[model samples]
Structure formats: C-alpha cells, structure tokens
Target: LPFWNKGSHSPSNHVIVAFEAYRQLSQVSIRPMTAISSMANIHEDICATAKRKEAAVIILPFHKHQSLDGSLNNTRNDFRWVNKRVLMLSWNFC
Candidate 1:
C-alpha cells in the first residue's frame, strides 16, 4: 500500500510505468492494492484491509510532502487525528 509515497499523488500512468521498470530491472514481483474511500470511513477502511490481509504493519498515511528545502508540510491538521484513529483501530495486528 502507498501511504503518501513519493509518487502516490502523481499521475497514475507515471507511477505505473516506474513500477513496471523497477519490477523488470529488479526481477521482483510487485503487487499493488488500491482503494478509494470517503474521509469519514478512511480509518475503518484501512483497518479492515489490514486485518483481511493479515498485514504485520500498517503504515499510517503521513499526509505530508517534503519540500525542496527539506521540510515537511501539509495544510490539513485533521490528518493527524485520522492517522491516530487508524493506528488505534489496527493496534491488534501490531
């Protein structure tokens, strides 16, 4: 899962092509799982997916991007709350 990956917000075709190249050059299998959910259900959605997949760890979305100056920034502060809720809901797996 891409939790605010460097290119998660980029064009899908760009990301796909990069992944394809990486997969071929490295000869490693890459399976991607993607889902779109409303903000209201985001935490629940992530928790459910993690449980269903029996994931050992859930990388809560950092929801910030690094600037050229090496600083992280995001306009939304509520993302912190959502991240906490996701971690709380998935605590069992940890």
Candidate 2:
C-alpha cells in the first residue's frame, strides 16, 4: 500500500473543481446523480493528478453499476493492472 500524503494539492484541487462542475448540474435542471459524464471527467482528472504526483488516490467512479461498470470498465481495468500507486474505491459499482 502506498502512503497517503495530506500535503498533496492535486486531490484538493480536483475536489474543488468537481464541486464547481457538479454544482452546475442543479442550474442546468439535470437529474440529481445523473451527471455521470462530469463525474467521470472529475475521476480522470483526479487519477491524472495522482499519477503525476506518484501518489495513491482512491476513486469511487460515480454510478458504479450504470455508468462505471459499462463505460468506465476499460479505464478501471487499466488502472487495476497498472503498477502506479492508485486504488479503486469499489468494483462493479459502489
């Protein structure tokens, strides 16, 4: 297991960006929890950030069963077998 670095700014930055992007969901009249695309982008950003820092990042891909299992299976598969420091928050949906 890789150590968690509290000093990392990437994760926190990703969180803030995610909040801002998702917050627009309400404004667009989109269904709650239906913004899987946005969430996926956020996950990718988080993963990329973690990869750049060589740190472990936990990712719970949104809509695990509906979106993740189908659309994100490839990315998840790649992450699973890769040697990078990362962790899948859940498999086959949360």
Candidate 3:
C-alpha cells in the first residue's frame, strides 16, 4: 500500500498500466476499482462493486502463472480463495 503514496505507485505501477491497457482495448468504459481492505474482506468489496456498477460479469486475474520454462509459479493462494468467494457470493456468476 506504500506504493500508493505520493511519489510512488502501485507495486511498480503494474496496476495502473494494466488498467490503461484495458481502457485502450475495451469498447465500453472501464475503470479500476481498488479496495483497501484485508484479504479476508476482498471478496465482499468485489461483489459490492459489481452490484453498484450493474456489471454483468466480474473478471479477476488468476492467482497462478506459467513461466516460459513451463514452470508453474507466482501463485497467490489468497487471491484464489478470494476469487472463489466472489463467484460464490455474486449472484450474476451463479
């Protein structure tokens, strides 16, 4: 969260960069919603955002990645758990 401070950015600015790319590629308007809550409560925030926005779908980044060497790493198990909770709680995905 320190990266969000002035003179800094979100973890090397990847979040901003990704959202900008999405904004460019998407036909509809898209904005990044950041929730400053504990991981345990992240799913709630996600669901709330979707509901307020009347969004039909909620897309979350996968917690895992495959490297060029075919190694499966960079996994955030907490995010995977949160994603499951989001899909479980959000009726649209149900």
Candidate 4:
C-alpha cells in the first residue's frame, strides 16, 4: 500500500491498489489534488503533510496541466485542514 508514494510524479503500485480498493470499498471519498502553491513553500508543506499522513487520492502524472497550480494547491490545503486525525490508508502514485 505504501509503495504508491514515489515522492514525485510517477504512478506507484499503491495508487493502483488504492484505486481498486476504492472501487471495492465504495464508501470512502477519494479526492485528487495538484501539488502547487502561491508561495511554493506552502505547497511543499502541504505535500509534506500528505506524505506524513500517507495520503490517498494522489494527483497523477504531475504534468503540466492548465489548472495544475490551482487544483493541487487547493487539494493540498484541504488535505491539511483534516490531516490531523484522518487516515488515508491508501496507496499513492505520481
């Protein structure tokens, strides 16, 4: 499950397994987010927190998309809002 987190933009096994798990589980909310912030450092913090928490629903590819900054930054921010107690329990990907 932890293998999905490769530290950067590359799909890990954990992400695939997590996606399948989500399909089977059907109750958990899997939300994906980008990895960017206005200050860049804040984005790094968000990413760090997510890594610490073993986040699920990771942003894939990390490619140059149109809304990459906005989406990922928001998701990271949202993940930060609830990272204290919540456990993602899923794999990650790039």
How well is each residue in 4-83 modelled by candidate 2, as lDDT tens digits?
Answer: 34466585455645555665655632221212234335555555654555543344433222364456334455334432
Candidate 3 lDDT over 1-94, as tens digits, reads 3323456555536766665666676855766665577887889888887888877656687888899999888589987898888878886534
| lDDT (CA) per prediction | 0.71, 0.41, 0.73, 0.48
- Give the range where candidate 2 is weakest over 10 consecutive residues by summed lDDT: 28-37
**Candidate 3: count of backbone clashes, pairs at least 3 residues apart or interchain:** 0
Ranking by lDDT: 3, 1, 4, 2
As for TM-score, the candidate ahead, 2 or 4, is 4
- The TM-scores of all predictions, comma-separated, are 0.55, 0.22, 0.61, 0.26
Which lDDT tens digits does candidate 4 get at residues 1-94? 4334556654455565676577667976555444455542444555566677677533533323257455532335444533431323222313
Give the winner by lDDT: 3 or 4.
Answer: 3
Better of 1 and 3 by lDDT: 3
Q: Which predicted model would earn the best TM-score?
A: 3
Alpha carbon lDDT of residue 80, candidate 2?
40
Better of 2 and 4 by lDDT: 4
Q: Is candidate 2 or candidate 3 better by TM-score?
A: 3
Q: Model 2 off-target regions past 4 Å?
A: 1-37, 57-94
